[model samples]
Target: MALKQSFSQKMEQKLSPQQIQLMKLLQVPTMELDQRIKEELEVNPALEEGKEEEEDEFEQEEYEEEIGEDERDFDIDEYLTDDEPAYKTSVSNKSKDDEEKSMPLSSGKTFQELMLSQLNMQKLTEKEVLIATYLIGSLDDAGYLERDLESIVDDLAFSQNVMTTEDELEGVLHYVQELDPPGVGARDLQECLILQMERRQDGDITRYTALKILEDHFDEFVKKHYKKITAKMEISEEDLKDAVHEIIRLNPKPGGSLKSSSKSLQQVVPDFQIVDEDGKLVLSLNGRNAPELKVSQGYKKMLQNYSEGAKLQKKDKEALTFVKSKLDSAKWFIDAIQQRQNTLFSTMTAIMNYQKDYFLTGDDTELRPMILKDIAEIVDLDISTISRVANSKYVQTQYGTFSLKHFFSESLSTDSGEEVSTREVKQILLEAVEDEHKRKPLTDEKLASLLKEKGYNIARRTVAKYREQLNIPVARLRKEL
Candidate 1:
């Protein structure tokens, strides 16, 4: 066979660098936008946080001349088109004095820092401290030392050039496990609970029996096999219940308790706020989402000086090129941010209007059937773009703060020939399960019959699928004494 050349043509779509940047920027929530802007500011010295002044008029002219009509076409009017409102105000029902405010500062030491401080209090040799530090680093977010001792020994020997034995590591680990969090260095859930139990001041029989169960019958205990446990341990049902209650009281996640104190707790920042103003729904972008950004005037001035200079040396030309590149990047970033704001506002506005009934009534049952395609068509954007806008973004409504994706649900038809949101069906399903008898929970077949009685003609398998989506277990798993 011989190589041959053939002519073929196909239509293709390509995203420019600025378009790619805008897509990525659109996906980040309000809480993370500030950090992203700060990262860009650090990398591109030509970017800054302030209003663009008139002093950079000469530089702006030169920049426009350097870049052609394609760049010039990227104006604010292009993004803020006819579909956008002229003056979209944020309406609030509360008076100015009743507005909620957030604390500007938070102060606390991290979990690792607290652990290290405790480690410093111990009177250990240099080698032992090194081993302990390695083990501490190996602790996961849940405060469990997930790495095995053999693996940790290898890591220490190879990475830190510190040769150590598993026995020595275990010795250091025991001391680390005594840290303030009570079970910070446990190897597993059982060990974490046991460590916390060991710290109990009262050595009661319940605690003793709980410890014994964990020490031996942990598997049976986890499976909730109360009959087996009571038989093997030769205890009555009430005694087994008391012992199991003691075990339940122990902290399964020892490291999680330190999260708040260690400043690891993350607060959800909504991207949009929908206010109910005089019975009408008003949508507004979060203040953090539309931060004021502009190009640095100093960099603009420098670029102007270089361009206006009579004699251009080799070094001067290179410097001018660098400045121009930075200036272009800064401009692109600012434009991308503005485009992101426009896209978010437009997408959310469409969603709010589409789900206006649900917002007004504050009822999940009132939500209309919608999907990404519907919103994409309304906003004149691609489905993928709409998906990026919906993924991590949150909206604060009068009812509560919810993810943007919550409003977009698949449609289902009832016996009366009316399209309804699947969310409505899920809501009814959730209520039925909550009111169900624990001794005899509703099975998927029974759930389907209940839904049919309520005018929703869903199959048993469909009920099971929706149940799984709502994170509800089966009847057998949900059953209780």
Candidate 2:
């Protein structure tokens, strides 16, 4: 017997406006931060750039307070005074109201647009085009449309008022696969490569291997079961080697050309730069993406003028309120951007210090075990906030630009009880495989034993896990013959 309650309390959790703001801010990248600010400026009339006349007094008071604190310190008058022209800018004081209203909205062709253009050029029947269009729409940003044929068929029949068969749609899918890039409409990796190979006229070794792998023993082929392949085919070691080479040459992704999974071209822009100055490393935040923003000085002045009037108009009061809210939002945004820069610099500086040996020597072996919590604690920020900064963000070094997330690797203890990075083990494993004899590839068990000899007590299963993470196939796949 179960007791059933007639009434249940509903639990509701709501995020603070500030938390929501921070979440939105975290979502914005360095490249888009300026544009976001400009967008805010356009939507909120109270939001303007540079200081208003009213804030000048407050700014002076703050400056005086800092200067008064220490007379013996370097004079701050130069930085504060208008005469010094340190903060003077040609565009900073421009009229905010007239500028934003006249700007045109941006529009551009997306991935769908490009694909639709190709479809339009093809001599497709209306029904075929409808199916093709629906199929194209179903695909994700990775260019993968994982839905089954039945679902698509149902969707077309019900929504488009067009009766279509899965077989017919599948036929059209084949036609789409034969479009630009050779393997666009393939259902999976094997199909994609096979489609490309089917279209190729050359009977190269790579093509032969690709066809064999796709048509037969695809599972074993992917798992690197080269021995099974050779045993079943009764092929010589040399022929097997050529077959494997051929398979390696074919593109794994069929629709990669249409929509690459890598960061969008615009997103590749680095957020920070580290330049050597004199004998020290100087880190500069790319603030160009953070445009100049300030409260609407004219609006604030108007509010002050209206406040003294005996009776303020309804429109005027509404305007004043709107101006204040927008000004506050603008100020909050600017402050958040400033805070973001400081936090980013501080966190990165701490990382650079912690991993000084790795940076100075450029040795992967020297990379110490570091987690987000370690840096978060050092930088006095929450781990989640630190993660937000690291995610999808790139730091440019003299060697090359790498994602900030690359530096943080989980720690692994060796057989000797010495802690090291898992990256180091992966690197060592990669090197060993690279140097091993290709005719007889080293099995995971043999790799484990070799690692044990090298004082790395990793198991065979663990070796497989690491190898898989590195996108390396097993010993059989690595075999040439």
Candidate 3:
């Protein structure tokens, strides 16, 4: 078949750079917005901190008009040469293997560093130290060393120029596991718990029994088959309960304890604050969300000087173009930030009004059925835009700080055929689970039946889903001696 010549025209809707910037800014929470602004100020010389000047608009228009009159060839896109493809210049020249990719490690003492510090404190030979270092570095964020001893042996030989056997590695690993946080060098969940219990045994029968249970019948313990464990271990119900208690007290994620020390404390700054001003709700965007940013007046003066010249030199045109680009960028960024604040406030205000009763009463049952589209329609924006506002952003209320996402829930019909928020149902489910007898915890079916008794008409699967979402385990797992 021969191809036919084709001449067709089509239009595509695309996000402009400014729009893209606004969308991204909309997702930035209050705490990080300051850092993001500082980064922008560093890159764009035309942007400056402090309140935007009142005369900035008039001066900017003057400079822009001057540039329009002269320097017709002064275009920012001119920097992109026709000889180089735009995408190619923006992309990496190195192959995937050649690229140096670094993991984003936490600040302060890392998990590896903590182990190494402990290693230094202990008396170990040079070879042992290197092997232990490798092992510590191999531990994942969860604190478990998931690699096999054989593979680690091979790795030490090939990468670290160290020779070792599985037996020697095990010896070093035993010492490593003895370090802080208790379970830093275990290979799996069972080993992690056993390592922790080993430190806490203290010759107590409960701890001893717990260690034995973990060492032998870990599967049975996990499955809640207490009868089988009591039969095999030949322990009484009270002894088994004490053993289980000891096991439960142990940290499942030993590395997680290290993470707090290795990372700085994160403070959540609400992006919006809603106040109950006598029966009326008043919404205000966080002051940080609306920073005073303006294009540098110095850059504007330079452009004005260039534009005033009678004749244009190539260098002059280039300098003018550069200043214009910076000024334009700074202006765009400032506008994008303002739009972000407006978008956030409007979206959150709509949500506050939509769930007015909930915000007023601090009761989950008062929240109305709402989704992204409901607020999107109210704000005359896209669902995705509303989602972005709801993503990392939080709002401060009379009750407490909550994510914007907390206010939005899918609707669930009640026995009265009235639509209610799934959040309300989850609240009821949570109360039921919390109040249920631990000796015989409520099942998903039982929970659903209870919700129906309270007028929430949801299915068993949904109840199970909600239970899991609440981080509640099954009834069997919830059972105790």
| Global lDDT scores for all candidate models | 0.80, 0.70, 0.80
Top candidate (lDDT)? 3
Model 1, stretches more than 4 Å misplaced? 1-10, 35-137, 147-178, 201-203, 232-236, 259-266, 293-334, 459-464, 473-479
Better of 1 and 2 by TM-score: 1
Give the least accurate 10-residue stretch of model 1, judged by summed lDDT.
Answer: 76-85
Better of 1 and 3 by lDDT: 3
Residue-level lDDT tens digits of model 2 in 1-481: 9998797789998976656676667657776766777787788776666643424543322222222434224332322233212222223223443233222333355666667778877789988998888887886654656788999889888899878888998888866665666666667777777777777638675566557767987887877776787798777667776766666776776555556433244436566767655546766665555555555666555545544444445675576556556645655655565566667778788888777776666678888899999999998988988898888778787768878887899998887799999888988999999999987889999999999999989989999999999999877767665
Error of 2 at 421 (Å): 2.8
- Tell how far residue 480 is off in model 3, in angstroms: 1.5
Candidate 3 per-residue lDDT, tens place, 1-481, comes to 9989989999999999999998888888877777898899999998887654444223222223334545475543322112112111111222344233223445787777777888877778899999988998898988988889999999999998899999999999888988998877889999999999998878788999999999999999998999999999998999999999999998889998776678866767677778998999988766633456766767766766665555666777778778878877977887777677668778888998898998889999899989898998999999999888899888888899998888878997888999988888998888888888988889999998998898887899999999889999999999887
| Candidate 2 local distance difference test against the native | 0.70
Model 2 stretches astray by more than 4 angstroms: 1-27, 50-195, 201-235, 259-264, 277-279, 311-323, 415-417, 459-461
What's the lDDT for residue 31 in model 3?
A: 73
What TM-score against the true fold does each predicted structure earn?
Answer: 0.73, 0.69, 0.84
